[model samples]
Target: MAGIVIVGAGECGTRAAFAARDAGYDGAILLIAGEAGLPYDRTKLTKPIVPGEAPFGGLSALRKPICHANQLDAAGITLLAGTPVGKVNSDARQVTLTDGRVFGYDRLLLAVGATARRLACRGGDRALGFRTIDHAQTVFAKARGKVVIAGAGLIGLELAAVLSGQGAEVTLVEAEALPLSRTVPAGLAERLMARHQAEGVRLLCGSEIEKVTPGFVTLSNGKRLPAPSLIAAIGVVPNTTLGAMAGAMIDNGICVDAQMRTSVPGIYAAGDCANVTLPNGQRVRSETWRCAMAQGIVAGQVMAGQTASYDDPNWLWSDQYDLTVQVVGQVADRPDALRQLPEAELQFSIDSDGALIGVAGIGRAAAMTKDIILAQRLIRAGAKVTARALSDPAIDLKSLLRTQGDV
Candidate 1:
């Protein structure tokens, strides 16, 4: 039988396989994993490595696998783990594996995900990139003593928090003026920097790593810092080599439509590997786990001959030092348009007409979850909200929506 082949058995690939089955596609389903182990939650790796008291154990320590091999088998999925696809014959609809095995597919889903971007410097090999469980384990083992991180992005900040919690002298280096300046507004970034500082993390903004030695690092600002261990969490580059080799269109990532259909016929792309075109003709790629899962399901459903489109606003969250930071829609693009609510932790961005376009919240998770949900609704509906109403904690969000007849 011509099978539905999924490449890169991370969250996106595994979820796509399951979604295809759930959508009632009976054809053979093949899930290929480049990594050796069974699929597990990559997001859970950072928190558990700290080895402190928490409500949850490590991802693998849980009884249930993130995507169990047995469960995939039960769903009639042929899982090829530890196997890497060497090439893609787009015209023939066949994939050549590194081990010389070939598989033909009626439809293909390329969810190859991404790899962490590394810093270019001498002794750079001494620095680790945290994208996989193995990398997390290696970093965790060597987290003692002074550890310098190369970026102050989400991953870098989270790792800094985790390592600092474990008694490591953590220093974060960033080229941007503020932490997460490109992702969140300056106010929220300032709060995050404050939180990190409160946790004893050293922040080095507007700096770059000029050179690295076995025991130390030199900054572009003429500062030398101890670096027994270094980690680079600058960003990620989408794994688009296979798709590109297959003649798929590539921009920032593999280009796909709302249906996740790639440029090549019978091929689709999702997760971090896919840059989806929005309604306004803007192409964006989300690296969050939620985005991967959502895009995978939509792609799977579309591949199964069901109509589906991924149109949800980009949403992501970060947990750091008792703060749950949530951001939805675009934040950085409208810096001047952003308005801080009376609640110091809440902020919103509006269009020219004052219609809500984005929302960001940072505070205790318990206090911010409901507000975040409401803010998401307002942003989705493009509701025009007054600053007074948004800032007033007493003004119920649902009531505000009802008052605007948005309910």
Candidate 2:
């Protein structure tokens, strides 16, 4: 009998499989994961897993990575580990594995996810990208060496914290004017700069590298920075090879509708592999753990015939230099209208059409909650909330729903 098949056993694949079973899909559920061991949290790959030591335990060493798999197995889901799909004959509703095994399915879900982007240089062998546990382990082994990271983004910054804590001299190189300048405002970047500088991380902003040589990366300014190891946390590209091969519409990622349905019939895509539309009419592909699991469950339920959509306030968090940064909603196209609450807590809010569209919180969890509640209120009202209302001191976060009427 034909069964439900899911590719890529990352967060998305695992979440979808479990959600499907929870929705009472009694048929056979087949999951294909390319990696060994059960699915664990990918965010922990760059950070120290145990949180206080260098060369810390790996993700495979985690005891709770496979809880979703256990739940799915109990629900009769067939999980295929160490086996990756080589081809997808979508017309025949079948998938060909690397080992020449073929499986037919009634419905297929593509949550194949993405891998870390590799460096573009001659000494590519020495350049590393953070993605899986093995990559972290390889990096942790050389934590004591002088390390130069290619990008000053979240992954690089996080790794800088871990390495610097363990007594490694870290230098971060960014082509942009500031660290994480693409996504974060200059003010926030300055705050991060202060935090990392205090933690003994060197930042080389607005700098370009001419080439990466053996044990050294030549800067564009003709300075050859010597380092024992190099890491590339530049970015990640979606795993759309299989989806494109199957004739699915691809534009940086698998294009999906509001319901997480792919272009092809009987197929759905979600997580980092799919482009999702927000309530504010923006299309984005979130690589965060929250988006992956949320969209995965949405895709799973929709594929199981429960019929739900994947539209929630976008949220992501990054841990760097002992600071917990929380960001919610998509930032608008405007820059001049961004506002901040105060200096002590470090909170920023950017609105679209007078409605709160983006919010960022640093140092305090309460700051994040305020922004979340503000965004939630704006979304619930389907209109803009007055800036005065947001800045009011009497506004209670836990009772925010009262602003929109009783829950």
lDDT top scorer: 1
What is the TM-score (0 to 1) of candidate 1?
Answer: 0.92
Per-candidate Cα lDDT values, in order, are 0.84, 0.76
lDDT of 2 at 313: 67
Off by over 4 Å in 1: 49-64, 332-344, 401-407
Best by TM-score: 1
**Model 2 misplacement above 4 A:** 49-69, 277-281, 332-353, 366-383, 398-400
**Per-residue lDDT of model 1, residues 152-230, tens digit only:** 9999999888778767789999999899887777778898999999989999999999898888999997889989889
Which lDDT tens digits does candidate 2 get at residues 50-107? 5455543322222237456557667888888898899998999999999999999888
Model 2 / residue 43 / CA error / Å = 1.2
